[model samples]
Target: MITVKNVTFRYKGNEETALNEISLTVVNHDFVGIIGTSGAGKSTLAMALNGVIPHEFAGDFYGEVLIDDEDTVDHAAEYFGRKVGEVFQDIDSQMVASVVEDEILFGLENFGIPHEEIGIRLEKVLRELGIEDLRHREIASLSGGQKQKVAIAAILALEPEILVLDEPTGELDPESSQEIFGLLKKLNEEKGITVVIVEQKIKLLCEYVKHLVVLDRGKLQFDGVPREVITHIDTFKRLGINVPPVAELSAMFRADGSYAGDVTLTVEEAEKMVREVLHDSV
Candidate 1:
């Protein structure tokens, strides 16, 4: 659903490029997670996916970004806006309305969606995002998690094909972060929405995302299955990102010659592998 080809961008009066010949493809309905340390160009890459590179930010650009076979550089921002829905790290910055219902309807209204249809989309989004009870509540009164949900509902109301999130859980507590991750998983699995999330929370992301992409200093470092990425625990540590707890434990056992099986990335899988090893040894 998205493609970047020889894409490189440098800010004005800057000596270095934020992205260095970066190229990636996200297929339809794939859930991709991007990880990296601070200043790793993760956010810059996310912006390029939806045409926020040269279009919204002034900079020198080389290469093409295509979404659904249309070139983002050639098209207008309004055209790109309809195809991609973005949720930023700060929920407050994304909010344009005071009430939940108004916030959800804001995008649809801007797109010139009809008045009657706006009501239908708003209801569907509220129900799908599990915010129906919050429909009439004040945005200021909602909790952090609720605020994030409302932000997501507002984006989903646009009916975009791809959802791009920049640290959606950055400001929330652990419990609230889990809630946001769960909603992203549901949206990707049940609704078949293409998801691309840039996050620092590797442990939570490993639970849901099918693919992982790591960046370092504006370069693509790793892009593959979650299991494969986590197997190199040392590399992840060096990059200042944590391996899933299960993966770390499994690695320890492997190092001690206690288990010689496949690397596990989830809690359940790690448990099963360890149990078999113990049983064999007995």
Candidate 2:
């Protein structure tokens, strides 16, 4: 549904490129994850995909970004905003409404949807995220996770074809982070919306996202399965990407020939691996 070709960008007055010759495509209903260490260009790539790079942030942009075969540069930021729903790590920065329901309504109204339809969109989005009870509450009163979910609901109300999230759970506790990822997975798998998430929580993403892309120093260093990227412990260390604890444990088993399978990226997979080793010993 999206294509990026040989795209390189540098902020005005900056000598270095934020992204270098990056190219990739995402198909309909695809769940993709992009990961890298700080200053690796992951966030820059996300903004570029969502039409925020050159449209809102000035830069020396090179190459093109296309959505559904339409040149993103040809469209305004508002146009791409409807095609792509972006949830940033800082929910407050994205939110504008005082009430939860109004938060969802804001997008619909901006899209010029009819007044009657705004109500329908609001109800559907609140139900989809199961935040209906919080509709009347003040946005400032909600917790971090609740605020994040409301942020997502606001974007989801727009009914964008693709959802792009930048570290959506970076500030949440582990349980809340898990909930956020679970909601995103449900949206991708059950609702069939394309999802692109740039996150550092590789293990959570590995559990839900099948395709992974890795970046290093503004370069596309790796693109494939998360298991493939995480198993190369030495490379991950060199690139300053953290290998999840489960992946490290599985790596030890593989080194000893006690486990022979793809590298595990989630706790569930690690648990299954442990059970297999015990059964073999029995």
Candidate 3:
């Protein structure tokens, strides 16, 4: 479990507070999504979760972030890194090696995993990510989507209990973005890893994550299940966060008392609700 209590931070040489008394809890195996406008502190919060805020980033920080009962401030950045893996927005910047196999091997080798066990873990992660064919491919030769997978595979090899990603799909096309979310969902459900993702793609978050968090100007704006949180359509609009079209349609029907069903997060759900309403009218 992750506990963030009354945490606040300010970057060095910057007067503005990057985070303000933000407190949240992510239980084991929870899939949480953070969304907000640009400069909303989304990336800052992701860094905090992975022990970068107080340890690496030179900042004035207050409060505490605890991972599994241990305080993050008391340890070095690399300490929590073993338990929490982070993937940044730019996959290329995270790459430390030229080839895919070397990239995955680097983390295991650094952590002092036994030499004999390294191959097993590397093969497991490569197969888990379905990137075994790209094991020998040069990192620069892979497409944007492939590079993103390799970045994730390298992290997964570490067997971290919690995975934090800051806009992992920000550079990808719509199709690639969906594929990454699907992969995260699979890891969360099957491997039982806790996943925290900062994404601008509200529709994908709603479809995959069990909980939704919204941050604005370094403040905790909203935190709840996606269905409950999306109902604040006016607030989302005021904050300039996009609501899925299907959710908008569902809210429209609910506003007029035409459809008393749940808020639809996906197109298929909206279609079913629409057919129900039409059938009733007939």
Candidate 4:
């Protein structure tokens, strides 16, 4: 479990606080998505989760971030990094090796894992990400989605309990975005890894994340189940955040008293509701 308690932070030389007394909890195996407009501190919060806020960045940070009751401030970022693996928004910035297999091998070797076990971990993570075929491929030759996958595979090779990603699919197309979200869901359910992702795609979050957190100008605005949070359509609009299209459609119907159900987060849910209403009318 991760506990963020009333955390406030301001970067050195910056007058504005990047995070303001934010408090939240993420339990074991939770798949969480953070969404907000630009300068909303979404990326800052992701840094806090992985112990990068107070450790790597020069800043005035107040309050506590605990992982399973362990205080993050007491340890170096690298220490917590072993348990909370982070993938940055820029996939290329984190790549250290030329080949996919060597990239995954880099972390294991640096951690001083036995040479015999390196290959085992490498094969396992590749298979887990379904990227075994790309093992021998050059990092420069991979596409955006494939590069993102390789970046994630490199992190997953370390077997962190918590995976915090800062806009992993920002550059990918819609189909590729869905594939990444689906893969994260699979990892959360199958490996029981706690996933925290900062995503701009509202529809993807609604479909995959168990919880959604919204931030605005360094303050947390909304935090709850995606369906419930997206119900505040007006608030989202005020914040310049986009509500999922299906959710907007459901809200439109509800306004006219034609739909009596909760906000629909997905197209399938909307379709089912329509079918039910049609059946009742007939």
lDDT of each: 0.88, 0.88, 0.93, 0.92
RMSD each, Å: 1.4, 1.8, 1.1, 1.3
TM-score of each predicted structure versus truth: 0.95, 0.94, 0.97, 0.96
**Which candidate number would show the highest lDDT if scored against the true structure?**
3
Question: Lowest summed lDDT over 10 consecutive residues: which window, candidate 1?
Answer: 82-91
Candidate 1 regions off by >4 Å?
A: none
Q: Superpose all Cα atoms of candidate 1 onto the true structure and report the RMSD in Å to 1 decimal.
A: 1.4
Residue range 156-254, candidate 3, lDDT tens digits: 999999999989988899999999999999999999999999999999999999999999999999999999999999999999998999999999999
| Residue 138, candidate 2: C-alpha displacement in angstroms | 0.9
Model 4: lDDT of residue 263: 94
| Reference-based TM-score, model 4 | 0.96
* Pick by TM-score: 1 or 4, better one: 4
- In the range 1-282, model 2's lDDT, one tens digit per residue, is 989999999988889998999999888999999988989998899988878887988889899999988887898878889888898756788899899888888788888988988888888998999988999999999998999899999999888999999988888899999998999999998999999998888778778797899889899988887778677787888988778898988998999999998788778889999999878989
Model 3 C-alpha lDDT versus the unseen true structure: 0.93
Expressed as tens digits, the lDDT of each residue in 75-147 for candidate 1 is 8767887678888767798799999998887889889989989989989999898889999999999998898
Give me the candidate number with maximum TM-score: 3
